[model samples]
Target: MNDIFSVLPDLGNFLVGYVTLTGVCSLRLFMVMFIFPPTADGLLQGVVRNAIVVLFSSYIAYGQPIAFIQTLRGITLIEVGLREALIGVALGYAASIVFWVAEGAGTYIDDLTGYNNVQVMNPSRSEQATPTATLLMQIASVAFWALGGMTFLLGTLYESYHWWPLTSSGPSMSNVLESFVLQQTDSLMQTIAKLAAPMMFILLLIDFGFGFASKSASKLDLMTLSQPVKGAVTVLMLALFVGVFVDQVKEQITLSGLTAEMRALSGGHQGKPD
Candidate 1:
């Protein structure tokens, strides 16, 4: 009984470390699904891909046997423990914000097209969303993964451990909260604008076209006929731009340098000293 009690701390630390890493990876994948438009190629490989991703992420966290052993040290338990969980949530939500651009844009489009009443049950979040919005979300998710979003996320997590190690001396709770809010608020709006800008531009053209058609055909009951026309245009535009959008997303993810930026943010905390 004495021996068991002595080892309990070590055991608890190891388990917590492992679970924290796993959960962070899972949350990353979840956020990607929520935010980005998925590519059609990924539709069939959905669950399998996520499983593989998590497995790979585990390797990233514990691949160093020595580090894994070090993480089992009973010191810094309380602080590191809480930090890991909060960081996981923060990273996950960041990804979600980026994805939400597609969701918000889709919602706006549906409302404009008179499809707001139709709802789709999204299995990912187990929530109801507009069908067009849901579809765009899925596509964005696929695009996120297809463009190596998992790699970027995992890289960010790894960088966190290296740059933001848990320390007995760290930032205050108020400081953490203030910095997090300020950082997220600044970036969230920018990310959403970047993702939605293209779609909104296209939609503006769509609106203009409809307006012109309506004016030219005064006797054709344009209001009633415009719905189908807009829907068709929306569908057509989405289909035509799917490939182009995916490529653009890939470029954006690369250019954004999310992994490096994440490291910088993590370092801002009482990270591990090199």
Candidate 2:
């Protein structure tokens, strides 16, 4: 029919726009999603993950014009995709920094409490980690989901398109981007110290007390007794502080610094760390 013929061209244009946008958008999402447990790769799960990313990208990119894909050539298209992937990876790993901070703080406690002597296989990573470190990492992963972290991640991804479009013909300016990473590193160190400080201080007192007892009661074998005492103390402290610890973990997991990163990516003035 004449009416069907008239609508077909518009339908074809819409399909072309959507396919191009989905390809650009989904690569970044795939990189980000794989960094989380729920979306990690398994044969069946990978397929589902792919479907979800494509759908979400399509949903988000629905109104955007993707005619820019027509302007890209072989090398240029590959360059754009590589840049998009790197951006996704960089953004994805930002989530893991909080996990690392939690694990680091726990490992430091392991050193203080003499628990580093024992290593446990982490089910998620399949690597041996000190018991406390393994525990904290698991806890951080839980807090990531329970505290709406996925929302923040997706929000950052959505906002990213505002600055770094598929049409970007060049790379993000390095000078603007440099300070963003430095600031994140500084924040990571500061967070580690903050989380570990209280436990460190208490454990130091126990060590000091044990040192004095060793001198005063030389025959008592306080060295044998001290490890158990420290273990008990660590357990008690962990129980008492875990609620607050989760709260702190919640703070670090947010991609709140992303707005600044977006501005920097676009060669705009970078904002200070949030």
Candidate 3:
């Protein structure tokens, strides 16, 4: 009886520590799952996704000492939760950037191919997008899975704990994060321009030829004829270069790139001690 009574305080402390660590870890993962393209935008799906992430985080966090504040309530807990959420969102945005860039490339091609008028509802995003954009988004999703991006994503999340542990205060490098975001945005635009260049060039040539023919023979509706021709050329170009585009996406959205971005967001900070 004495032993049991004496051990109660220690046991209670252990349980509290375990729960705190798991909750903090789970909070971060919940934000990631909430913002990640594959898991976000669905209420039930988000819940299920967060559950899975929390499970994985729990496994990773097992036997780890609780390095966070002991109290689950108060200003510290609130601050910690907010910090974790920010980290998760930053990581999720980094992961989703590739798909956004691919979609932008497709949108640019649509503008070149006279397909901008053919807009359809995107089920995933609840926004209207050109058919080409929708198709590219779908293809990007498939390529993301085929290229082992899911594995990379999970690994990155796991490794993030090492760089910015749950116990750590908020990220330190605000200027670095701002710069990284600006750089990524610029890179995304450049990538889209590159991807759409071939189609744009071909379509421009077709338009110029049609314009010349129209000036030569005013009675002929060259403008009307140019639309179908441009569309056909776009289809052909896509058929020929789809493999190249997928490979490029796979190369750019790599594990190393994601890890580097995460490290930058976290300021390469080590985990905090209890």
TM-score-wise, the better of 1 and 2 is 2
Candidate 2 displacement at residue 220 in angstroms? 2.4
Scored by TM-score, the top model is 3
lDDT of 3 by residue, 1-274 (tens): 9999999999998787677767877776777666655555622365577678778878755845444435556777777777777777777777888778778988998988788999998755667999888878777777776678778888888888778766555445476468768977898788788888877888899999999999999998888999899888888887887788877667555544788767766667785543
* Candidate 1 Cα errors over 4 Å, as ranges: 1-78, 167-169, 197-220, 251-256, 267-274
Clashes of each: 14, 0, 0
Rank by TM-score (best first)? 3, 2, 1
Tens digit of lDDT per residue, candidate 2, span 30-76? 89777753344521266788888888887656655445645445776
Give the better candidate number (1 or 3) by lDDT. Answer: 3
TM-score per prediction, in order, is 0.65, 0.79, 0.85
lDDT of 3: 0.75
Q: Write the per-residue lDDT of candidate 1 for residues 23-43, one digit (tens) a residue.
A: 543443444433333312235
Q: Residue 88 in model 2: shift from native, Å?
A: 1.2
Error of 3 at 239 (Å): 1.3
Instruction: List where candidate 3 sits over 4 angstroms from the true fold.
Output: 1-21, 42-44, 60-63, 67-69, 170-173, 254-256, 264-267, 271-274
> Which portions of model 2 miss their true places by more than 4 Å?
1-21, 36-45, 60-66, 169-173, 254-274
